[model samples]
Target: MIPHQWYIVLESREIKPGQIVGVTRFGERLVFWRTTEGELVCLRDKCIHRGASLAIGKHHGDEIACPFHGFRYDKTGKVTLIPANGKSSEVASYFHIKRYPVREKLGWVFVWWGESEPTHEPVYFDNVDESFSWSSSRHLWPVHYSRAIENQLDLVHLPFVHTNTIGRGKKTLVNGPVQVVRDGNIAFWVYNEVDHGQKPKKAEDLPPPDFSRQHIHFIFPNMWQNYILDKMRVLVAFVPVDESHTLIYLRVAQKFVRLPLLRKLVDFLALRFSQVVLHQDERVVITQIPIATQLHMEEKLIPGDLPIITYRQMRERLKNV
Candidate 1:
């Protein structure tokens, strides 16, 4: 996994007040819950005392009480009240459990990974706001998080994997697929002109990204967006469940249908179509050899892979920065 970056792990709606949600992320067992006032809290799921799962414990206001010994903890992972001891007992400093910093933005939950304090707010795209109604779905992919991300960055596979859907015209040749990486964000545009049985044009020969057209982009950690049009988009958050598993949170957002009731119907239908396309990609992605990708992996690469190569380079650069 990449170091010192904010990764989107869950949608904001998944956690609710007075409830503890437990899941394994980044190969670590974690539990998330909200205080009565609705502030998000994330902590290691294990109780430091007997190594029991904290998720099964009871939640009282902001404090969660261990079911086995009645040890209670606050949002900061500090033991606030140990029922086994007197109510006025002072908890030792060593009694605290591990806590992780969390933030919510754009209806997604982000967790900061690594030791360094975050220097900037979580990065998100503009224009995709509450005005655009969204519907979300999640799927578990038995591949590394990087592989799931690189699948979207791949431009050459559309015609082959999605031949019956997005690749209807058989535009087998690729051109330009220019990329611009700046400010920890990467956006790339494709210029796929019907090949006249000629060699593909180099990335330098193509124009820079035209945001007005349909394109794809990646935000530093694990968020991605495909701008289908001015009022339509498809977003994906590739969550690293572990070294060999990833949970993809896919959402379809649109403002084309403004009426509330009609919009729900439209969004629902759109999501179904999106799911079909996603499964098409999933079938092929799961079969990739050595599911995890490396910056220096052995493969015959071509000029059409400029976006993917840039993504790998940026990931390597972010590891130290």
Candidate 2:
């Protein structure tokens, strides 16, 4: 969508060792694989020699051999050897495909979708330490990546769309002031004392609950994080397949549950519960007509829509950049 510098398309675990995974992102067919040395490679899925899908090819050590013509391509997307040509043939010099830069961190695979060399490392949760355990899942949404992203920045939807779970009988009206701040491509939102059907209390009149703080953040393009509590966090990334489709990756990070057996139990229960909540959001977001449309033309907004409005504006600015 935005002229890509870098877009995260999948988690590192999804692309296993010696395995090639075909990903259709931003309207392009990409093949991701790990070489024998454990390095990750991403290239157009189409073989340069005869246009065969590389996804159907086999991996030979650090190279992928085309199934149709037996043309072997190295991890760099360069033709290493073509059976149709002589061993001394310079054919490998002339046939090469585009190679995208990829990096794996925090169990996620990040691909640079833009033209320039990325100067910074991919973002990860620095706050996660020995106290936390993490697990993730992936879902494909039949909606634009922008739509999926806007849904994350939207705080107003919780009471209605997620009322049964996250909202849990809370007030539907958003009466608090929403704050937005940007640090480079990352943006953070703080919704203070938001009304959720409970009686409003004065700031000085209340004691802090076990997990009272609420915050959400957007890491440019398609990553989002919600600090649900001091011990729990949710990380989401939207992968664009085209103008009207996306693959959503969800990860639940948790802390304070230190016992090995108990951690596994907690993660399992938390992941399933989170999946239900996410599916509800997906059902509503994916069913919207036209997928992603001009915000002004699609719906009128009030104060509660401030986060959505800010998100759109930031997206527009990134597009222009």
Candidate 3:
């Protein structure tokens, strides 16, 4: 997995104040919970003592009580009470579990993917927040997270994979598909035209574009968005469940219609449409020879894969950042 970036691994509603949820993400077992006041907390699922899984433990009023030893821990993962030494005993400073920086935002939960402190907030779409209405769903893909992400970055497969849907134009020839990367983490590209037998132009030969039409942007680590318009777009979180599994959280957000019932209707229909498109991409992605993609994988590439090329390079760089 790429380092030093925030990955959306869960949905906000997945954990309530009095609950503890545990799942495997980024190839690690993690347990997530919230304080009584609703602040999110995350830690390595394993208890330092005897390697017990903290997820099965009970979450008392304000502390997590280990089911094995009744050792109580606060939101900081610091032990406050060790049942064996008596309830009033002072806990040793070394008695603590590994804690990770976490946040709940834009209908998802993010976990920092490094050992150091987080320096920035999780990236969010320009205008996506409480102002927009959205419907979300999660699907499990039996492939590496990188494969799932590249399927979206791919531009050359549209004509053959989604011919009757978004690829109806028979745009087999990918033009410049020019790219712009900013802040070292965000990259966007533009190209949505049908080929007319004209020789495809190189990225350097393309002129400026109006980014407002349809934007495809990716944030390092594991997030991407397709800005279809000012008020509608699709956002996806490629959550790494393990090297061979990924859970994709797909959300279709819109604000063009704000009425109560109407907003829900529009968001629902959009999500349904997006699912169909995602399934089409998934069918072929899972069949690739190698489930995961590497920066220098053995494959012949062409100009049509410029967006994917940028992604692979950036992913390699981010691993060191």
Candidate 4:
């Protein structure tokens, strides 16, 4: 079942100022654009007149003019002007498109992909802001969006899947209990301790060590954030291209501290580092068979999979609602 809520569709940079891009997600053809004033809007791509794709049309300042018959639409999906029609009444009665609500936050464009009004505003991390430096990349994968999302929520596979890279030398099984917390549409999983070979210890084994922690948060439908530490973070937004394909937007966020040279250097390194880690995850996720299969009755899950179960149940409940 598909969860009904706003999903992160693209990184904000994918649609530049005054540029319009066509995106097909979850069987919907959408036109995403930024106004001259830098506001973002997303609407159904099909024009009411002649069934032309509005994404292939031109943008005149704030309005998008359909290329086929010069039908113009405003950001709200109302046909503001129709060149073929003489009066406004005719255009008003026949020329409207479905417009989805869009909100820009933390360098990403979020779209309400469901039928109902979103119950809450999009969530943002405390460290995400203009002061923080960030860079992003986009990749289209041959897998369902749910599979891509579940890959992020799985902690037990990291030690084996990413062994040569991010998970090198990490413990295979985590010792301490995994902590799970939720608020509305947001869910977070924190693995506090790793088996260090001596004896099973609690999360607070080294009393007040450092500011290092492993934290991953999934905000509703399609956004996931992993905090490697205080200074580095990885944010992933998954957009469903179809039932069997997905587009992934990866953002690496780091503290800049007002130093231009250091910021540039950090941003460059972060982008490369993120790409390496992402490719590792993608290699495994895309190879999974039966893209749209549900996990409720297939496998034997244990306590380590509590987070995954929670996410799956939430998705099922939301879809039923």
Name the lDDT value of residue 103 in candidate 4.
96
lDDT of 1: 0.88
Candidate 4: the clashing residue pairs are none
Give lDDT: candidate 3, residue 221. Answer: 78
Candidate 1 regions exceeding 4 Å error are none
Model 2: per-residue lDDT, tens digit, 160-211?
8887898766556554433545543443343334454575343234442222
The TM-scores, one per candidate, come to 0.96, 0.88, 0.95, 0.87
Tell me the spans in candidate 2 whose CA falls farther than 4 Å from its real position.
Answer: 129-131, 184-212, 294-296
Instruction: Candidate 4: count the clashes.
Output: 0
**Top candidate by TM-score:** 1
Give Cα distance to truth, residue 78, candidate 1, Å: 0.5
lDDT of each: 0.88, 0.77, 0.85, 0.76
RMSD of 1: 1.3
User: TM-score order of candidates, best first?
Assistant: 1, 3, 2, 4
Model 2: how far residue 206 lies from native, Å: 14
Candidate 1 lDDT, 1-321, residue by residue in tens = 887888898998998777788999999999999988889999999999998888888988779988889899999999987777889888888899989889998889998887677776677788588878989899999999989999999989888888888766778789987777887788988677677888888787877678888889888779899999989999999999999999999999999999889999989988888888899999999999989887888977888888788888888887757
Positional deviation of 203 in candidate 4, in angstroms? Answer: 9.0
**Model 2: how large is the Cα RMSD against the reference?**
3.7
